[model samples]
Target: MKLETEIKKPSHQSEPDYVTGKKDEIKSYGFECTDCGADINIDFQRQIKYNWTGNTDLISESERTELKKYYGIGLSEKSHDGGYPVFDKIVCKTCGEEYLTYCGVREFSNSAYSIHVQEIQKIK
Candidate 1:
């Protein structure tokens, strides 16, 4: 079972009333490798939050493939509560590993000296 801490927020920001009112927008661009194939072409996207929520198709397919070959994602994040945005997850799909509360977006943005650099570096 997945364990989660009871996250508390400073200010209350009402939940976003999505048009669909459900988990939507699933944009996942990566490889699916098993003990069989080298790397499967797993390039797909949907406007639902089943697998991926805030993720988008920013990087190209070619770039995504290359990224999977090199530095693949260790985790993904989304808005857990109505406080603010945060990178509160790290999941290793290969080993079925997950880590939460590793990063706080608000804290990072507030202290990041090279905010511009971070923006460019963090995103594709």
Candidate 2:
């Protein structure tokens, strides 16, 4: 897969605020395909794992630190328990564009999941 440049946010937004906003709050959060501009919902459970091997090379040092602090867990640390610190490769249902998304799951009754997508890049 060929790696493309990082996705840029709109001029009005400072950071990728959509990355942390709830799906209900942000209508286009994590749904738009960067390549095709298709609105495709991401099914985390059904999507194939990216088999990241816990490599932090794809992400910047500041992003790695921010992710760890926000998630309250180390990105490279392995959990004895299952289901956390998800790093998966997801395909765009419309254009077949692949993306490597890093996410942190909150183990509440509802199990909130947030994707850190400031640097989400397309993979060919």
Candidate 3:
């Protein structure tokens, strides 16, 4: 019988990982029903750290890039207190129930806090 062993090396040098908000803030959001005409709102103060506003606005290049990294969640942008940018929002198609339901914010995550990233760590 024969046994073989292989050594693995790191791909990159050691670097401190950052996993926090670039800048913490709240982005508001509003929802509107397509069928009816009802309106609603949701506050993403803690989740994504953004306020809720019912309007559409252009996102910044850096913000867009950050959002692209995340699958579901974005950054916080605000034009004004009442006219701030919304992170996430959703509306019912079948019913006319418009409600604010979305928090669009993405931040770098640490392996320690992330379940998906810590899967291997759970092993004995």
- Residue lDDT tens for model 1, 32-97: 232232332222212231122222243344543343333223344322321122222323345543
In candidate 1 the C-alpha lDDT for residue 34 amounts to 28
The RMSD (Cα, Å) of candidate 1 is: 17.1
Question: What's the true lDDT of residue 120 in model 1?
Answer: 9
Ranking by TM-score: 2, 3, 1
The number of clashing residue pairs in each candidate reads 8, 0, 22
Q: What is the lDDT of residue 71 in candidate 3?
A: 24
CA lDDT of each prediction against the hidden true structure:
0.26, 0.44, 0.28
RMSD (Å) per prediction: 17.1, 9.0, 20.1
After superposition, the stretches of candidate 1 with alpha carbons farther than 4 Å from their true spots are 4-87, 106-124
| RMSD from true fold, candidate 2 | 9.0
Kindly report which residue stretches of model 2 are placed more than 4 angstroms away from their true locations once superposed: 8-29, 44-83, 108-119
lDDT of 2 by residue, 14-116 (tens): 3322222455545233557877898755444322132233323455555545544643555445322222444445677777887755543223334333332
Candidate 1 clash pair list: 24-47, 24-48, 24-49, 25-47, 25-48, 26-46, 26-48, 75-91
Q: On a 0 to 1 TM-score scale, where does candidate 2 land against the true structure?
A: 0.42
The stretch of ten residues in a row with the least summed lDDT in candidate 3 is 114-123
TM-score of each: 0.19, 0.42, 0.23
**What's the lDDT for candidate 2?**
0.44
